[model samples]
Target: MGLLDSLEGMAASAMTNSGSDQAKVAGGLMQALQEHPEGVQAILNGFQNNGMAGHVEQWASGALQTATPEQVQTGLGGTGLIEATAEKAGVSPQMAQTILATVMPMVISHFAPNGQAPEQSQFSGLAGQLLQKFL
Candidate 1:
């Protein structure tokens, strides 16, 4: 299998194992990217450089905690992120619960150097930008 293919299988397992909608999470990630495209890009780059599933899990859990069921379904469900998630290592929706089952303590401990949520926004401006750029 090629890279995307490998990513697809991993996403299948990750989503099945994760028990949540990949669309929602991916959408949320997009939203986050929209809000702070540069910051989100930087974070993704950091994750890539670190190549650590644990770190991805921590960040994903934090991002998903207060997320609603609608957010879960629309963002993660059937968005092909099931395959993409393996690339990130964090699970979605219910899988997030599974992935974080024993990781609560660790998630609480991580702090941004600036001590703030970088992608924090009520709306995803970067997502719009992405759509505009792609469309």
Candidate 2:
């Protein structure tokens, strides 16, 4: 399995052993990250590698809090992804956020139920497609 799928599998196991709200959120967040291949790949070997579960256990499971809505928006707003999208599509930041907001839910759902992660091929296609949508 790919890093993405492996992360989701770990998250699925984490969910079964969830001990707190934070743990659940972390588990879900991990799944979501895995499902979003681009995001996961960005940090695949960065920090959330073979030790992701430990990071979650040490931080997210307790001290690691999930990001707020503002944080999520700000993160997307600050990323090169937004500018690239806007430039390609010739749309404003506001429009970009609107599109991202709509797509965010789908990304979440992609990791739903069993916390299944998406395929890298799918993610590659999606990442390019999402960027293209703005273009």
Candidate 3:
């Protein structure tokens, strides 16, 4: 199956297993990130360019600093990721921001372990692992 199809399946499975809004939003954000042309790099770059490189670095280094919703909105403001995630999760953009505040750090840490971003080829495997964790 295509990556999109796989992501849909994973998100559906997550919803089935947990039935939690957070899980659904996490899955949606994962889908959005995967579907982005730059994938997770765009997210990293967004934070980096928005003067939130410290936050991204902390997350990459396995620190557990939680992003505030406003921080999430600022870091991800123009990426269109938030809107995509909101649509996929069937949530309002504001709600997506709130959920993303909690989830984005984990996503970054998983995909960019030890302060390094994974190769694009590694994304599929890592995404599955991440989805499992969220579920």
For candidate 3, write residues 1-135 as lDDT tens digits. Answer: 877777678877876788788988888887887788877888888898999999998998888778999999889999999999999888899999998898888988999876567876777678888889878
How does candidate 1 fare on TM-score? Answer: 0.24
The candidate with the higher lDDT, 1 or 2, is 2
The model with the greatest TM-score is: 3
**Model 3 stretches astray by more than 4 angstroms:** none
- 1-135: candidate 1 lDDT, tens digit per residue: 343343244333433444344433433333333333343434434433444334445445564243333433333334333234333444444653333222222222232322233343422332333223212
For candidate 3, give the lDDT of residue 58. Answer: 91
- What is the full ranking by TM-score, best candidate first? 3, 2, 1
Model 3: which residue pairs collide? none
lDDT of each: 0.35, 0.41, 0.85
Provide the global lDDT of candidate 1 against the true structure. Answer: 0.35
Q: Tens-digit lDDT track for model 2 on 1-135?
A: 665555555545544554443333344444444443365433322223433433223332234344333433554543345444444334454554455444443333342212333455565334333222222
What is the Cα-based lDDT of residue 44 in candidate 3? 87
